[model samples]
Target: MNIKLIAIGKTDNKDLENLTNIYQSRLGFYINFSIEIIPDIKNVKKLSEEQQKQKEGLLILSKLSATDAVILLDENGKQFDSVGFSSYLQKYMNSGIKQLVFVIGGPYGFSPEMYTKANGKLSLSKMTFSHQMIRLFFIEQLYRGFTILRNEPYHHR
Candidate 1:
Protein backbone atom coordinates (compact mmCIF):
# COMPACT_ATOMS: atom_id res chain seq x y z
CA MET A 1 0.00 0.00 0.00
CA ASN A 2 1.11 3.57 -0.59
CA ILE A 3 1.65 5.68 2.55
CA LYS A 4 1.21 9.42 2.36
CA LEU A 5 1.85 12.03 5.03
CA ILE A 6 -0.25 15.16 4.63
CA ALA A 7 0.65 18.10 6.82
CA ILE A 8 -0.42 21.72 6.75
CA GLY A 9 2.33 24.27 6.05
CA LYS A 10 5.98 23.85 5.18
CA THR A 11 9.11 23.52 7.32
CA ASP A 12 11.35 26.55 6.92
CA ASN A 13 14.42 25.11 8.70
CA LYS A 14 17.03 23.75 6.31
CA ASP A 15 18.48 21.37 8.91
CA LEU A 16 15.12 19.74 9.48
CA GLU A 17 14.48 19.55 5.75
CA ASN A 18 17.78 17.70 5.27
CA LEU A 19 16.89 15.14 7.95
CA THR A 20 13.40 14.62 6.55
CA ASN A 21 14.91 13.97 3.13
CA ILE A 22 17.38 11.44 4.55
CA TYR A 23 14.66 9.36 6.14
CA GLN A 24 12.38 9.70 3.13
CA SER A 25 15.09 8.12 0.99
CA ARG A 26 15.54 5.33 3.52
CA LEU A 27 11.79 4.68 3.59
CA GLY A 28 11.72 4.30 -0.20
CA PHE A 29 13.24 0.80 0.18
CA TYR A 30 10.18 -0.43 2.11
CA ILE A 31 7.13 1.58 1.04
CA ASN A 32 5.95 4.15 -1.46
CA PHE A 33 5.97 7.05 1.03
CA SER A 34 5.45 10.68 0.15
CA ILE A 35 4.90 13.95 2.01
CA GLU A 36 2.35 16.50 0.81
CA ILE A 37 2.31 19.93 2.42
CA ILE A 38 -0.84 22.02 2.39
CA PRO A 39 -0.23 25.72 2.11
CA ASP A 40 -0.98 27.79 5.22
CA ILE A 41 -4.35 29.43 5.18
CA LYS A 42 -4.57 33.13 4.38
CA ASN A 43 -6.01 35.66 6.87
CA VAL A 44 -5.49 33.33 9.80
CA LYS A 45 -5.31 36.31 12.12
CA LYS A 46 -8.95 37.17 11.65
CA LEU A 47 -10.30 33.67 12.24
CA SER A 48 -11.25 32.28 15.62
CA GLU A 49 -9.73 29.00 16.77
CA GLU A 50 -12.80 27.02 15.75
CA GLN A 51 -13.07 28.82 12.45
CA GLN A 52 -9.44 28.22 11.70
CA LYS A 53 -9.77 24.51 12.35
CA GLN A 54 -12.82 24.35 10.11
CA LYS A 55 -11.02 26.10 7.29
CA GLU A 56 -7.99 23.90 7.64
CA GLY A 57 -10.19 20.84 7.83
CA LEU A 58 -11.80 21.74 4.52
CA LEU A 59 -8.43 21.99 2.82
CA ILE A 60 -7.38 18.71 4.38
CA LEU A 61 -10.55 16.94 3.36
CA SER A 62 -10.08 18.17 -0.18
CA LYS A 63 -6.80 16.27 -0.52
CA LEU A 64 -8.42 12.97 0.31
CA SER A 65 -10.02 10.65 -2.25
CA ALA A 66 -13.08 8.48 -1.66
CA THR A 67 -10.94 5.36 -1.52
CA ASP A 68 -8.23 6.67 0.79
CA ALA A 69 -8.14 5.72 4.45
CA VAL A 70 -7.15 8.73 6.58
CA ILE A 71 -5.54 8.66 9.98
CA LEU A 72 -5.12 11.80 12.01
CA LEU A 73 -2.01 12.37 14.12
CA ASP A 74 -3.71 13.63 17.24
CA GLU A 75 -2.43 14.24 20.77
CA ASN A 76 -5.11 12.06 22.34
CA GLY A 77 -4.64 9.23 19.86
CA LYS A 78 -3.26 5.76 20.38
CA GLN A 79 0.44 5.46 21.23
CA PHE A 80 2.45 2.55 19.85
CA ASP A 81 5.85 1.08 20.53
CA SER A 82 8.18 0.54 17.60
CA VAL A 83 7.31 -3.09 17.05
CA GLY A 84 3.62 -2.48 17.54
CA PHE A 85 3.71 0.34 14.99
CA SER A 86 5.34 -2.00 12.52
CA SER A 87 2.56 -4.45 13.08
CA TYR A 88 0.07 -1.65 12.62
CA LEU A 89 1.65 -0.94 9.27
CA GLN A 90 1.54 -4.65 8.53
CA LYS A 91 -2.17 -4.77 9.25
CA TYR A 92 -2.94 -1.89 6.94
CA MET A 93 -0.95 -3.39 4.12
CA ASN A 94 -2.63 -6.71 4.68
CA SER A 95 -5.99 -5.01 4.46
CA GLY A 96 -5.17 -4.05 0.85
CA ILE A 97 -5.44 -0.31 1.14
CA LYS A 98 -4.71 1.69 -2.01
CA GLN A 99 -3.45 4.69 -0.10
CA LEU A 100 -3.17 5.16 3.64
CA VAL A 101 -2.96 8.82 4.57
CA PHE A 102 -1.89 10.30 7.88
CA VAL A 103 -2.44 13.94 8.59
CA ILE A 104 -0.73 16.27 11.03
CA GLY A 105 -3.34 18.91 11.64
CA GLY A 106 -2.95 22.66 12.11
CA PRO A 107 -2.09 24.31 15.47
CA TYR A 108 -5.62 24.24 16.86
CA GLY A 109 -5.87 20.58 15.85
CA PHE A 110 -8.56 18.82 13.81
CA SER A 111 -12.10 19.96 13.50
CA PRO A 112 -15.17 17.85 14.27
CA GLU A 113 -15.53 16.77 10.65
CA MET A 114 -11.91 15.73 10.27
CA TYR A 115 -12.03 13.76 13.50
CA THR A 116 -15.19 11.95 12.50
CA LYS A 117 -13.90 11.07 9.04
CA ALA A 118 -10.63 9.60 10.26
CA ASN A 119 -10.23 5.81 10.26
CA GLY A 120 -7.75 6.08 13.15
CA LYS A 121 -5.71 8.53 15.19
CA LEU A 122 -2.08 8.07 16.24
CA SER A 123 -0.01 9.91 18.78
CA LEU A 124 3.79 10.07 18.76
CA SER A 125 3.90 11.68 22.21
CA LYS A 126 1.75 13.29 24.87
CA MET A 127 3.70 16.54 25.04
CA THR A 128 3.05 19.36 22.63
CA PHE A 129 5.50 19.61 19.74
CA SER A 130 5.98 22.29 17.15
CA HIS A 131 4.07 21.31 14.01
CA GLN A 132 7.27 21.49 11.96
CA MET A 133 9.17 19.36 14.50
CA ILE A 134 6.40 16.75 14.50
CA ARG A 135 6.91 16.30 10.76
CA LEU A 136 10.55 15.35 11.32
CA PHE A 137 9.79 13.14 14.31
CA PHE A 138 6.96 11.20 12.63
CA ILE A 139 8.91 10.62 9.41
CA GLU A 140 11.90 9.40 11.39
CA GLN A 141 9.73 7.06 13.40
CA LEU A 142 8.20 5.78 10.17
CA TYR A 143 11.69 5.02 8.85
CA ARG A 144 12.59 3.40 12.15
CA GLY A 145 9.40 1.30 12.06
CA PHE A 146 10.14 -0.05 8.60
CA THR A 147 13.75 -0.79 9.54
CA ILE A 148 12.60 -2.69 12.61
CA LEU A 149 10.15 -4.62 10.45
CA ARG A 150 12.96 -5.64 8.12
CA ASN A 151 15.32 -6.57 10.98
CA GLU A 152 17.67 -3.81 9.90
CA PRO A 153 20.34 -2.25 12.15
CA TYR A 154 18.94 1.26 11.98
CA HIS A 155 16.60 0.69 14.92
CA HIS A 156 17.78 -0.77 18.22
CA ARG A 157 15.33 -2.14 20.74
Candidate 2:
Protein backbone atom coordinates (compact mmCIF):
# COMPACT_ATOMS: atom_id res chain seq x y z
CA MET A 1 0.00 0.00 0.00
CA ASN A 2 1.07 3.56 -0.59
CA ILE A 3 1.39 6.19 2.12
CA LYS A 4 0.65 9.89 1.90
CA LEU A 5 1.15 12.69 4.40
CA ILE A 6 -1.10 15.73 4.18
CA ALA A 7 -0.40 18.90 6.06
CA ILE A 8 -1.53 22.50 5.91
CA GLY A 9 0.99 25.17 4.99
CA LYS A 10 4.51 24.76 3.67
CA THR A 11 7.47 24.18 5.96
CA ASP A 12 9.27 27.47 5.36
CA ASN A 13 12.05 26.56 7.76
CA LYS A 14 14.80 25.34 5.47
CA ASP A 15 16.30 22.97 8.03
CA LEU A 16 12.99 21.27 8.74
CA GLU A 17 12.07 21.00 5.08
CA ASN A 18 15.40 19.44 4.21
CA LEU A 19 15.16 16.90 7.02
CA THR A 20 11.59 16.02 6.05
CA ASN A 21 12.72 15.59 2.46
CA ILE A 22 15.49 13.22 3.52
CA TYR A 23 13.02 10.94 5.28
CA GLN A 24 10.70 11.19 2.27
CA SER A 25 13.48 9.89 0.07
CA ARG A 26 14.39 7.10 2.49
CA LEU A 27 10.72 6.08 2.61
CA GLY A 28 10.53 5.83 -1.18
CA PHE A 29 12.74 2.72 -1.07
CA TYR A 30 10.03 0.80 0.78
CA ILE A 31 6.79 2.18 -0.59
CA ASN A 32 5.12 4.78 -2.75
CA PHE A 33 5.27 7.75 -0.37
CA SER A 34 4.23 11.31 -1.05
CA ILE A 35 3.69 14.54 0.85
CA GLU A 36 1.01 17.08 -0.05
CA ILE A 37 1.16 20.61 1.28
CA ILE A 38 -2.04 22.57 1.48
CA PRO A 39 -1.31 26.23 1.13
CA ASP A 40 -1.93 28.42 4.16
CA ILE A 41 -5.11 30.42 4.12
CA LYS A 42 -4.63 34.00 3.00
CA ASN A 43 -4.87 36.75 5.65
CA VAL A 44 -5.29 34.18 8.41
CA LYS A 45 -4.62 36.87 10.99
CA LYS A 46 -8.14 38.16 10.59
CA LEU A 47 -9.75 34.75 11.00
CA SER A 48 -10.75 33.36 14.36
CA GLU A 49 -9.49 29.95 15.51
CA GLU A 50 -12.75 28.20 14.73
CA GLN A 51 -13.02 29.86 11.35
CA GLN A 52 -9.50 28.86 10.45
CA LYS A 53 -10.13 25.24 11.42
CA GLN A 54 -13.29 25.13 9.35
CA LYS A 55 -11.45 26.50 6.33
CA GLU A 56 -8.55 24.12 6.82
CA GLY A 57 -10.94 21.22 7.27
CA LEU A 58 -12.49 21.86 3.89
CA LEU A 59 -9.07 21.89 2.26
CA ILE A 60 -8.00 18.73 4.11
CA LEU A 61 -11.14 16.88 3.12
CA SER A 62 -10.70 17.90 -0.50
CA LYS A 63 -7.34 16.12 -0.76
CA LEU A 64 -8.72 12.75 0.26
CA SER A 65 -9.91 10.17 -2.22
CA ALA A 66 -12.92 7.97 -1.57
CA THR A 67 -10.85 4.87 -0.84
CA ASP A 68 -8.13 6.44 1.23
CA ALA A 69 -7.92 5.49 4.91
CA VAL A 70 -7.15 8.57 7.02
CA ILE A 71 -5.19 8.52 10.24
CA LEU A 72 -5.02 11.74 12.20
CA LEU A 73 -2.16 12.58 14.51
CA ASP A 74 -3.82 13.73 17.70
CA GLU A 75 -2.63 14.08 21.27
CA ASN A 76 -5.60 12.24 22.76
CA GLY A 77 -5.24 9.19 20.58
CA LYS A 78 -3.78 5.79 21.40
CA GLN A 79 -0.05 5.64 21.95
CA PHE A 80 2.08 2.78 20.63
CA ASP A 81 5.66 1.68 20.86
CA SER A 82 7.80 1.36 17.72
CA VAL A 83 7.08 -2.34 17.34
CA GLY A 84 3.39 -1.75 17.83
CA PHE A 85 3.33 0.94 15.20
CA SER A 86 5.07 -1.31 12.72
CA SER A 87 2.50 -3.99 13.43
CA TYR A 88 -0.25 -1.43 12.91
CA LEU A 89 1.13 -0.56 9.51
CA GLN A 90 1.47 -4.23 8.64
CA LYS A 91 -2.19 -4.74 9.44
CA TYR A 92 -3.24 -1.97 7.09
CA MET A 93 -1.08 -3.29 4.30
CA ASN A 94 -2.33 -6.82 4.88
CA SER A 95 -5.89 -5.53 4.68
CA GLY A 96 -5.17 -4.50 1.10
CA ILE A 97 -5.66 -0.80 1.61
CA LYS A 98 -4.89 1.36 -1.41
CA GLN A 99 -3.57 4.38 0.40
CA LEU A 100 -2.90 5.15 4.03
CA VAL A 101 -3.28 8.88 4.49
CA PHE A 102 -1.87 10.56 7.62
CA VAL A 103 -2.85 14.13 8.38
CA ILE A 104 -1.16 16.68 10.64
CA GLY A 105 -3.62 19.43 11.36
CA GLY A 106 -3.01 23.16 11.60
CA PRO A 107 -2.32 25.40 14.63
CA TYR A 108 -5.62 25.16 16.46
CA GLY A 109 -5.99 21.47 15.65
CA PHE A 110 -8.67 19.74 13.58
CA SER A 111 -12.26 20.80 13.19
CA PRO A 112 -15.27 18.65 14.01
CA GLU A 113 -15.69 17.68 10.38
CA MET A 114 -12.14 16.38 10.26
CA TYR A 115 -12.64 14.31 13.38
CA THR A 116 -15.71 12.73 11.83
CA LYS A 117 -13.84 11.85 8.64
CA ALA A 118 -10.82 10.18 10.23
CA ASN A 119 -10.59 6.38 10.29
CA GLY A 120 -8.42 6.46 13.40
CA LYS A 121 -6.06 8.59 15.47
CA LEU A 122 -2.48 8.02 16.57
CA SER A 123 -0.44 9.76 19.22
CA LEU A 124 3.30 9.80 18.77
CA SER A 125 4.05 10.63 22.37
CA LYS A 126 2.46 11.71 25.62
CA MET A 127 4.17 15.10 25.34
CA THR A 128 2.84 17.86 23.14
CA PHE A 129 4.92 18.81 20.12
CA SER A 130 4.78 21.72 17.73
CA HIS A 131 3.15 20.94 14.41
CA GLN A 132 6.48 21.49 12.62
CA MET A 133 8.28 19.05 14.91
CA ILE A 134 5.51 16.52 14.49
CA ARG A 135 6.04 16.51 10.76
CA LEU A 136 9.69 15.72 11.25
CA PHE A 137 8.99 13.11 13.90
CA PHE A 138 6.25 11.38 11.97
CA ILE A 139 8.30 11.11 8.79
CA GLU A 140 11.27 9.68 10.60
CA GLN A 141 9.10 7.20 12.47
CA LEU A 142 7.50 6.07 9.24
CA TYR A 143 10.89 5.46 7.73
CA ARG A 144 12.06 3.61 10.81
CA GLY A 145 8.93 1.47 10.86
CA PHE A 146 9.55 0.27 7.33
CA THR A 147 13.12 -0.56 8.09
CA ILE A 148 12.10 -2.51 11.16
CA LEU A 149 9.54 -4.42 9.13
CA ARG A 150 12.20 -5.44 6.68
CA ASN A 151 14.65 -6.42 9.42
CA GLU A 152 17.10 -3.75 8.33
CA PRO A 153 19.92 -2.65 10.61
CA TYR A 154 18.63 0.92 10.67
CA HIS A 155 16.07 0.15 13.37
CA HIS A 156 16.74 -1.67 16.66
CA ARG A 157 14.80 -2.68 19.72
Best by lDDT: 1
Model 2 backbone overlap count = 0
Q: Can you write out model 2's per-residue Cα lDDT over 96-156, one digit (the tens) per residue?
A: 9899999999989899999999999999999988787889999999998899899998886
Least accurate stretch of 10 residues (summed lDDT) in model 1? 148-157
Leading candidate by TM-score: 1
Q: Which sections of candidate 2 miss by over 4 Å? A: none
**Candidate 1 stretches greater than 4 Å from native:** none
User: How many backbone clashes can be found in candidate 1?
Assistant: 0
Cα lDDT, model 1, residue 1: 89
Encode model 1's per-residue lDDT on 54-74: one tens digit a residue: 999999999999899999999
